[model samples]
Every structure is written in structure tokens, then in C-alpha cells.
Target: MTTSIRGTANADVLTRFRRSAHWKPLEYAFWCLPVLAYFAFPGNYLLLSQIAITGLFALSLDLIFGYAGVISLGHAAFFGVGAYTVGLMGSHGWSDPLLGLLLAALFAGIVGFLSSFLLLRGSDLSRLMVTLGVALMFFELANKLTRITGGVDGLPGITIGPILGVFDFDMFGRTGYIYSVVVLFVLFWLARRLVRSPFGQSLRGIRMNALRMPALGVPVNRRLVKIYTIGAAYAGAAGALLAQTNQFVSLDVLSFQRSADLLLILILGGAGHLYGGLIGAVVFVVLHDQLSDLNPQYWQFWLGLILVLLVLFARGGILGTAQQWIESRRQRTQARQRAGSTS
Candidate 1:
């Protein structure tokens, strides 16, 4: 009787595990799309590479805002810091792309860690103002420090060496695209693991009710600081990739427009979901590319109209809407199955 009971318990555990594993197959298939795109559209590598970098940037934003409920408008600060770190290092003869990426991430992470205290002390509106202020400060600083950042003229003369001393960053952007995609996949995988962990659940709880989290023995502030720092590091790494791939850095890296655009991308893709960033980036970049070519003067107007419609109709963004639709279908099918089984 004891052995039979133990076996039944193990079976129940296995069933629970299998049920929880439903999303894994879908996630794996989603990742495979980029790889397939690389082979299908070889000539569009440069454009695809841009989309990958932008997607990574948006993903970092989603980490803090979507997952941790830390609303920041100055994410571009970390991004600029990362870009400048790589550009300045390359200009000074340390052209190793991998090293530059590491240094950039470290610098940005440190900055995020230090700045997180200020961010943690405020309401959402206050946080927004403070974050925007931080980015503006960085933008002005980069502009004033002409010798290092190159100011309005931009940071030129940046030269990135080959990846692992093997794959050179070619003019065609093949190496750059592959590199960005790989980094994105690795980071996304880590993020997937993180959001599914106990720590991630704590973050979600805090996001739902910060005041109640402290009562539950959750270290709310500490968790926020950690996720913020991690997000900053990811943003920095994305910026470094951009600088290395393009072989240049500009004050635009620190601009408010970049921050705003990133926020838009996150909203378009749907927050609180991992695939939102990737889907939003593809839509935004592709639309921008196609529309600008068609009517550069009025493209912004059309884009704005589209965004207005999305905001009104798709409350959860593209991915969220799609997920909801799929869920509804599954529920309907299950209901029918149950009805038939009863009959």
C-alpha cells in the first residue's frame, strides 16, 4: 500500500510538470523564426540586424517596466553610456568588440544600481520625471564633452575588431546580424528562466501590490534594484552592439526621442510578455522603412494614426491580443470536448 501511494504521488507530480510545460514548445518555435528569416532573406541582413538590436533594447525596457513595475523614461541613459563606452574604447585602440560589450554592460549596471535608489523613492509620475531628467542630463553632458563624445558631430573613428577573432563585422552586416541574434537569444533565454523563477514571482507580486509585498516578507526594494540593474546591463549591451556594428556613436543615443520610441515599441508589442519586444520591433522597423520610402513627409502622421487605433482597439498590444485570441479558442474547444464527454 505504501509503495502504491508513493507511485501515485510521483505520477501526480509528473502530470503537473507536463501541464506547466505547455508554453515551452511555442517559445522554441518563436525563436526559430529569426533563424529562418536569416536564410530566407539574405539580402536584407542590414535591416534585419537593426530590428534585432532594437528588439533587444525594447526587451530590456520590458524587464523593468513590464515585469518589475519600474517605469523609467531615462533608459536611454544606460544605452548611451554603453554606446559611448564602446566608442571611446575603440577610438582609444581597444577595438575588441567582446571586451567593449562587457565593459559597457558593467558600466551601465553600476549606473543603474546607484540610480535605482533615487528611482525607488517616488510615485509613477515622479519616477517618470526623474528618469526623463536623467536622460536629458546625459544628453547635455555628451554634447558638452565634445572631446570624448564628439558632441553634435558624433563619435567617429570607432573600429570594432572581429568577433572572437573569427567572424569579421562585414559591410553587408551578416556577421553583425548573426551576432545580435545570438546574443538576443541567450539573453532572452536567461530572461525566460528569470521570470519563471521564484524571484520572478516575487517581482510579479510586488508589481501587483507593493504595499502588501513587505507584509509577506518580500524584500521589495532590493528586488527592484536587482532587476533595474539587470535591465540596465541588457540595455547597455544592446547599445554596445549597435555601436560596434555601426562603427560609430552619436549624441542621438542619449536623446529623449530614443527613449520615447523604445516606450512606444514596448507598448506596441505588449508589456508583461517576453515576445512583445521582438514582435513590436519587427512591426515598427518594417513600417518605418516602408512608409518613409513611400511618403517621408507624411509618414509620421500615418504612423501616429496607426498607433492611435492600436491604443484604442488593442489594449494589450499585438502579442497580448493574439494570446487572448488563442486562449479563447482553446477554451471553446475544451468546453465542447467536455460537453461531448458528458453526453
Candidate 2:
């Protein structure tokens, strides 16, 4: 009877897990935006491709910051590793996009795994400094390695061949935009699955109470390391996508500004939720294009003001606030129905 009870409990847990991972109608609608954009704005393929790449990068950060509770200021270290991996391969005549991405993820994941030990040792502030230091080191290394990385001039001579030997990258950016969107969708799907898994639940527990988690037999450090490595791999994949799409690599890929901007995007979109980064990226990128065009000199001032307002008023961020409002409305409606039934 005890064994049967345990089995039933396990089955119930599994059912809950499955339900949590199930797709929602809103997800279907969210994906439709990308498809609609492809048809609606053929002239802005380049911008749209950029939004996709940035969204992937922000999503990676969300895995670390939102889910794992790891704060990193130098997450671009892995991104640079991935971009340079693809760049170096392309320069050497290895132009296979899939192979380049695999290698990039491998290298970045290794870097992340190795560096994760440092994060385990320090407090949040220390971790921040360590991350920033690692990124700066990579930036300097890229700057000094003129022969290989091409220094400030960027890594030129990166010739990416057709993706799968079928679709060639063109002048109008059609293939690149489609390729980026497809990659984003596949990775997003995988990330969604991961965050809903049992392992992901443990991560949430860790984030909520890291000290209490170990009492439950969860290896906090190991889980953190795994998520950090996974996040690095995701960032690396994003970097690889950017390199493949643009057919170039640059020092800016590892810049602190890129990492900072990514944080801003996450802040604007709200972290924790899977779709937060994507939503944030869309808003950030669109606002940036519009604002920059409107006022190239002081657009940042406006962006900063907007972020200030968001922080002061919307603590949960755009999606988080929206979700809260929806829940409250549903509760109110149920309460009203209950009152009417009593009457």
C-alpha cells in the first residue's frame, strides 16, 4: 500500500509537470507576430533579424538571472567566445552553419563551466566583479590579437556559406531573417521545456531560498553551475547566430555595453517569465531605432527616463504587471459571480 501511494504521488507530480509545460493559446499568438512581421515588413528584415538575435541573448540572461538567481555583468564573455568560434572557423574555410553553431556552443559551454566555479565562491557583488573582469579580459585579448581577431577593425573575411546548402544569404536579408527566426523558435521551445521540468522547479526553489534548498538534498552549487553553463551555451548560440547572419564578427560582441543593454532589455520586459526577454527585446530594439532616428544625440536620455519610470511604477515589469492585473480581474469576476449566486 505504501509503494502504491508513492507511485500515485509520482504520477500526480508528473501530470502537473506535463500540464505546466503545455502550450497556451497566448503562445500561439505570440509566435504569430514574427510570422506576421515577415510578411508585413519586408524592408526591415535587417532590423527584425537584429531583434531576434537580441531576444535570444536576453533569453539567455533570463535563464541565469531570472531562473537561477545568478547575477552576471560579463555574460558577453561567452557570447564573444561563440562569435569568435564561428568567425575563426569561417576564416579557415569551415563555413557550415550548423557545425559552427555546435562548436560555438561547445566552446562557450566549456568556458561557462570552468568560470562557474568562480561564481560559486563569491557573493553577488564579487560575482559581478568577476564576471566583468572576465569580459574585460576577453575584450583586451581580442583587441591585442590583431592577427586572429582583426582587432578594432573587426574580424573580416568571415564567409558563411548557404545554410544547409539550400538557402543562401542574400543582399536583402530574407534568408538571414528567416534563419534567425527559425533558430530562435527552436531554442525558445527547448528553453520553455527546460524551465518547466523538475530541474527547473529546483532552480525556482534555489532562487527563492538558496539556503533552505540544500536541506532538501538539492545540490545548489551544482544546479547553479549547470544553469550557468546552459545559459552560456545559449548566449554562445545567439552570438553564433549573429555572426552567421552578418557574416562578420567584431570586438563589440564582447563589450560591456552590450551586456548592460541586455540587462536593460530584461528590466523593461520583466524577468522570470520565459517571454519577458523576447517582449523586452522587441520594445528595446523598436524604441531604439525610432528614438535614434528621431534624435541621434540624446536618445539615450529618453530611454533612461523610460527605464526610470518603469522601475518606479511597474515593479514586476510589463508582462509581470499584466499577468497580475489579469489574475486580479479574474478573481474579482469570480467573487462577483459568487455573490450573485448567494443573492
Candidate 3:
């Protein structure tokens, strides 16, 4: 009986592995796109680097807002925290990039864990207010601490050492672009794994119906706190990457506009999907770049018009709409196939 049960478990594991193997090619292709772009657009590395950072930041917000149903308006608090952590460390002579990144992430995680309690008792609107307040408070605090944070002048003279004791960040941003891409790809992979895991499913369940989750034995508050902290860590890492790549920290990192822009990116890309943040970042950044170049003074108007149309018609943002279209076509094709076979 024991041997038979062990064999059944092995068979189940093999079956699951086989099922998941179908997506391996798609996943490989997805990750390989950045590498292809790296070689294809050598002149556009800086813009690409910025896109990767923005995408990572948006992805962090999606973890809490998209997956856990935690509505926050001050997510930039953690991002700023991470940026300053690296800035201060670099200023004080601990310029090791990898260590700085890890420490920045750790500090941001701690802040998020502490702040999670405040978020637990609020309605979505209240939570928004609380989050915004938290970010504002940090912004003021960073401003006041001029000696350390450099105040309005911004934190200057930040010197980041070579990554992994090699590959220095150069003026053209080639190294930075490759570095940011690698980090984003690794984190994205981990996040993809997480969202496909049981814990991720639980967060989705909580998002769909929090009241129902408790009755189903889910620890709603704990789960929320955990995901929030994880999101904060991711945000921090993104910030750290930005600071290290640029070797500067500014009060703007903690600004309300940063948070709002991130929220807008998520909305534009569509929420509750893993690729939504990345797609949104690309669209938002590229459009902003193009529009601003064309009409600097009235770019906002054009951007607003695009957003309005997107919200009105493409309710699921780009990825969601594309997925729906593809699925519909697939269904129709399958139906035709079945009909022909029957006939």
C-alpha cells in the first residue's frame, strides 16, 4: 500500500510537470525579447532602461492593488526609501552595488511590514488617504533632513561601485540598461511564479471576495500584510536600481505625482494581470516621449484623450483586450473545426 501510494504521488508530480511544460517555449520567447531589443536598438538603451524601471515599479503596485485588492496611493514611499538608502550608503563610502540593493530592499520591507497594520483597518478610500499621508510625511521628513538627504538640491555625489566588482555604469547607459533588464527579468520571473502559486491564488480569491475568504479559512489580514511587504520590497529594489544606475537621489522620488503616475500606468496596462504593468509602462513612456516631442505644451491634453478612449472602450487595457480578442478567434476556429469534423 505504501509503495502504491508513493507511485501515485510520483505520477501526479510528473503529470503536473508535463502540463506546465507546454508554456516553456512561450516563457523563453518572452524573456528573450529584451535581449533581442538590446542588440537591435543600441542607441535607445537609456530610454529602455527607464522603461524597465518604470515597469518594475508598476509591477510592485500590481502585487498589492491588483492581487490583494489593497488600494494605495502612496506606493512611492517605499521607492523613495530604497533610493535614499542606496544614496546614503554610497555617500558614506559603502558603495557596493549589490549589497546596497539588498539593504535597500530589506529596509523597505521593514517599513512596509510596519505600515501594513495601518492599512488593515481602513476602507479603500481611507487606505488611499492613509497611504498618501504616509508618503507625504516621508517626503517632508526627507526634505527637513537636509544634511543627509541634500534637501532641495537633491542628494549629490553618490558613487556606486562596479556591479559584482565588474561592469561599471558608463555615461551612455549601456551597462545600466543591461543591468536593469536582467534585474527586471529575474524579478518578473519570480513574480510570475508567485502569482501562479497557491499563495497567489489565495490573494486573488481575497481580492474577488474578502468576506468569503475568511469563511474558507484564509487568514485575510496576514495575507494582505505579506503581499504588501513583498510589493514594497520589489518597489525598493526598483528604486535602488534607479539610484544606482543614475547615482543620485531626489525628493521627487517620494512625490505624490510619482504615485499617481504609477497608478495611471497600471490602469492603462490593465490591473490583475502580470504583464499589464510592463505593457502599460512601455505604452505610457513611449507615448509621453513622442507626444512631448511633438507638442511640449499640450502633450497632457493628448495623453488625457488617449486615456479616456482607453478606459471607455478597452476596459481591460491592452493585454486584456488582446487576450479577449485572441480567445474569441480561437473559440471560433475550434467551433469551425468541430463543425467540419461532424459534417
Candidate 4:
């Protein structure tokens, strides 16, 4: 199976991931550093938490789009389903955090599984239409089911339960941030493990050639279904996290813009790279925050321009470029040393 990276040396990046013992400590620090920073700065809790939630959502897309080569426009369907599930559950006074999370995953997974037939078609344009159609149907349903969904007015007054029956969500947003970060990291770790496993290789193989995989006795369709369901669960879990933090559910949360925004993030981060989704999410959210503060109208325009530049010029996004430059420099230095030693 062909890996995401192109060219000989680029392949080494994925294959030799653990060869550099130096990266081990840094990789550990990468996960730990954020949590540490979150703890250190009380005021930044809300920001960090929200960022993690968005990052998780984007990560879902990365799993499918980046790893599985599947393009989905209806991602918001699962996200919305997860959010509305939480809202519905809260209305019934079912607010245990774990229950909500589990329900979110179940609901999203089912939705994803059901939607896999559409996703399996896998034509870029057809997949877009199918995915977008699903999201639109969900959005309209939310409006039509006013009695249950609260309709356009939104299902307000949701009361999320305390964390593990311990930390009560407060006005200062402490619990929300911590809950989001912890859950986000746990799942993020799971995602990392997933793509590293044999399943991940199967996905890459399927992405490269669906016809060959089935002929070779691999269940191509089944893998697609499994990964789609997993991705949907990730999206749904993200929605649940968002609902728990905000204590409010709105139809807007499941809109096309959310899905579109997530796509932009993954593209910007250079999907297929495990860290790409989060990196893109951070850049996007930070840009949104800063730009919105300056002027809402201009933010979209400027960010859009930046995105065009990225898609056109940056193949691997920021990290990809850095990796390329480092590899190039290393190659040059090695060549120079070899020449001098021979001289």
C-alpha cells in the first residue's frame, strides 16, 4: 500500500517514525504540554477547551479525508445528532457525563454506519452531494421537529450534569474546559493509536486501490464502513463535548459552515499527518478569534485568501513545509560532508 507521503525520503518519515529516539521525549511533551499549560493559566481555560473541541471535530474529518481518502460533506449530521442527543437526554434529566459521551458515540456511529452506503460511492463530486444532502436533511429535520428539537428557537435551558458526579460546571467555565481537554486528548490518543495499527494500513491500502483489496480477500467495503462509523463517533463525541461545555444546543452547531470550517482546518493542517488536524484547528480558531475581534467581515475574506494560498502553495501545510526544508537541509549537509571527507 502507498503511504500518504510521496517520494522516497518522505516515505521514511512515516516508516521510521520511532527510529529517532529523540522524538520520543518530544512526542510525550507535545501531549503533556497542552494539559500543563491549561492547568497553569486559569483565564485561558475557556479558550483552550473550545480549541480542543474544534480540534476534535476537525480530527474526525482528518481520519476519513486524510487517512481514508473519503470526502464527507454531511459530517455535521453526526455532530448534530450527538449534540441533539445530549439536548434530548438533558431534557429528560439524564446528565451523567460518561453516559452522554457513550450515547454520543452510539448515535453518531449508527448514523455513520447508515450513511456509509452513500459514503462508499466515494466519487469526489457524488460524495460531496451525498454528504451535503445528509446534513441538509438533518438540519431541516431539526427545524421540522419543533416539539422535540425546540425548532428555530433552539432547545435552550440544557443543564449538563457534573463531571463524573464531582465537578459542577460553573459560570467561569472551568469544568467545561477541563472536561473537553481530557476527553479530547483521550480520543486523540486513541486516534493516534488507530492509524498506527494494522487497520490504518488497511485503510491506506483501500484508499489506494479498492478493487485490488477485495480481489486480495480484504473486505474493502467493511473497512470503509468501520472507519466511517468511527469517524462519525468522533464527530458525535465532539458535539457532545461542545454541548456539555456550552450547556446549550443550537441548530447552527450542525450547519454546513461547521463542516466547511472543519474541512478548511484539515486542509490547512495537511491531513494524513496525525498532528495536522489539531495544528490547523489551532491556527483557524486563533485566526477566527483575532480576526473577529478586529472585524467579522474582513476575517472571512482574509482567512479565505490565506486558505487559497495554502492549498495552492503548501502541499503538507505548515508542518509539511518544515519537514521538507529540514530534510532538504540535512541531505545537503550530508552530501557536503561526504564530498569533503573524500577530498
Compare the candidates by TM-score and give the number of the best one.
2
TM-score, each model?
Answer: 0.93, 0.96, 0.92, 0.90
> For model 1, how does the per-residue alpha-carbon lDDT over 1-343 read when each residue is reduced to its tens digit?
9999999998986686555535677787988888999999999999999999999999999999999888888999999999999999999999899999999999999988998888888988998998898889989999999988999999999989999999999998999999999988889888877876668878889889999999999999999999999999999999998998999999999999999999999999999897898899999999889888999899998888888899788889999998999999999999999999999
Candidate 2 lDDT by residue in tens digits, 206-234? 99999999999999999999999999999
**Rank by TM-score (best first):** 2, 1, 3, 4
Among all windows of ten consecutive residues in candidate 2, which has the lowest summed lDDT? 306-315
Question: 1-343 in candidate 4: lDDT tens per residue?
Answer: 4544366667676566445323367577778867786768788777877889988998898888888888877799999999999988987889887899899989999999998887677577888899899999999999999999998888887878888788998887877887888888889888887887668878888878877888877898888899999999999999998888887888997799988888888888878876888888888888888888888778888877878888788878876776789999999999999999999
Q: Which residue ranges in model 4 land beyond 4 Å of their true spot? A: 1-23, 39-41
- Decreasing lDDT order of the candidates: 2, 3, 1, 4
lDDT per residue, candidate 3, 249-336, as tens digits?
9999999999999999998898888789999999999998989999999999999999889978988888888889999999999999
Pairs with steric clashes in candidate 4: none
Local distance difference test, candidate 4: 0.85
> In candidate 1, residue 193 scores what lDDT?
74
Worst 10 residues of 4 by lDDT: 14-23
Highest lDDT scorer: 2
What is the TM-score of candidate 1? 0.93
